[model samples]
Target: MAKLQLITPNVAYEQDYKAFYQDWQDSGRAIIPSVAKDLPADFAGYVQRLNDNAQGIGLEEGIVPNSTFWLVNEENNEVLGAVNIRHQLTPYLERVGGHIGFGLRPTARGKGYAKTMLALSLKEAKSLELEKVLITCDVDNVTSEKTILKNGGRRSTDEQTEEGIIVHRFWIDL
Candidate 1:
């Protein structure tokens, strides 16, 4: 197995990213970390958007500045997954969205990649000067719950969304 590294979104990884995107699409599941959803047709533009979002440039309503990273296998150059780290949280985020959101390609699931992806993301969160971060997963997402626990996340509470979806919330002290 190749070691994985987290990288910022860039045009250089366009092909690998497209494959990663397709894998999620083919899974017929709702993409996580909203940032990875609805990629624009123009790859370059999509990359630019991610970069701009990180810098708090031209943000949309209700959006906070966030950094997005691609988890890649350096040897094979495959984009295995992605993580989005929000610099700050809003009321909604405090309730459910949380500060960190991440997902792996369908084929990459259940192989400990999520743990590494998250551990790496926390480093990025620390670099952003975040002392602590909130992470949330669906109440039924056992895999995520375990991953969070492995990363030193302490269960704080569980929140129910307006739509009545139960979400488990954990806090990681960075």
Candidate 2:
């Protein structure tokens, strides 16, 4: 529970980001916001990709423009977590991905960082002029469900992905 700030991905935080990435790798959980998965060796390139994604440049098929932010502990300069906010949703995203995807490092969990990180992401959503946002999580992921609920998310309906995963969808008014 350090002073947290959500920042756009940048080379200035390369080292911290590497460590954060490693932590997620070590946890053996699928990285939330698939954009954060399989990071390239070039940290600069990765940062640039995140920037490009925000600008709707060089996006892969079916991918929409999105903003990615790192939640950092300002006091210690540690990368605590990340959040990806999609500017618009595709059919698949509407059903499973939602507008916001976020996660904290294993070491940062259970310290109230997720809630704060999500609150900040909601602010970013509002800045994007979104009237509301869809946020989804695994139906079994109680922690995330709680976070979404605390953030004023209203339960919509559960969706089953093609992969057969049950996803809980919620909407928050901006």
Candidate 3:
């Protein structure tokens, strides 16, 4: 691992962003980050959408104000993963999504980056004045569970979604 830092995605990171996006697609992951919902084929539009979401502009229904950050290897400026922190929870989030959601490129997995990135996201959540942050992962996702635990997350409860998926929820006090 190189010196990693979370950064707001921008035009200067276009190539790195594309690589990350392609890796996500290649991984065949079912869930994408909230900030990736409106990604356009063009870099300019993608950048604009990221800015809009950050500012609470042109948000779709049921969306809350949030922040998105890309974890980058500062040594080589490689975009490795992304994390989204919701400013506040809605009914749906309270049940399922929680306050933070994160994913790493397939190539970046199993390198302990998830734990590192998650720990960083918790700091961002604390800065938002949240006394604690809620995080949830699918029950079958062992890596995620371990990451949450390493970040001081305590198992709160498990609930089944309408889609019949069991999710484990955890909370980390600030």
Scored by CA lDDT, what does every candidate get?
0.92, 0.91, 0.85
27-94: candidate 3 lDDT, tens digit per residue: 77753565764446688877767667778998899999888899999988889988898989998899
Models sorted by lDDT, best on top: 1, 2, 3
The number of clashing residue pairs in model 2 is: 0
TM-score of 3: 0.92
> Ten-residue segment with the worst summed lDDT in candidate 1?
156-165
lDDT of 2 by residue, 65-149 (tens): 9999999999988999999999999998888888999998888899999999999999999999999999998878999999999
- Best first by TM-score, ranked: 1, 2, 3
- Per residue, candidate 1 scores C-alpha lDDT tens digits across 76-149 of 99999999999999999998889999999999987889999999999999999999999999888999999999
Against the true structure, what is every candidate's RMSD?
A: 1.0, 1.1, 1.6
What TM-score goes with each of the models?
A: 0.97, 0.96, 0.92
Q: Supply candidate 3's per-residue lDDT for 159.
A: 66
Best by lDDT: 1
Q: In model 2, what is the error at residue 74, expressed in angstroms?
A: 0.3
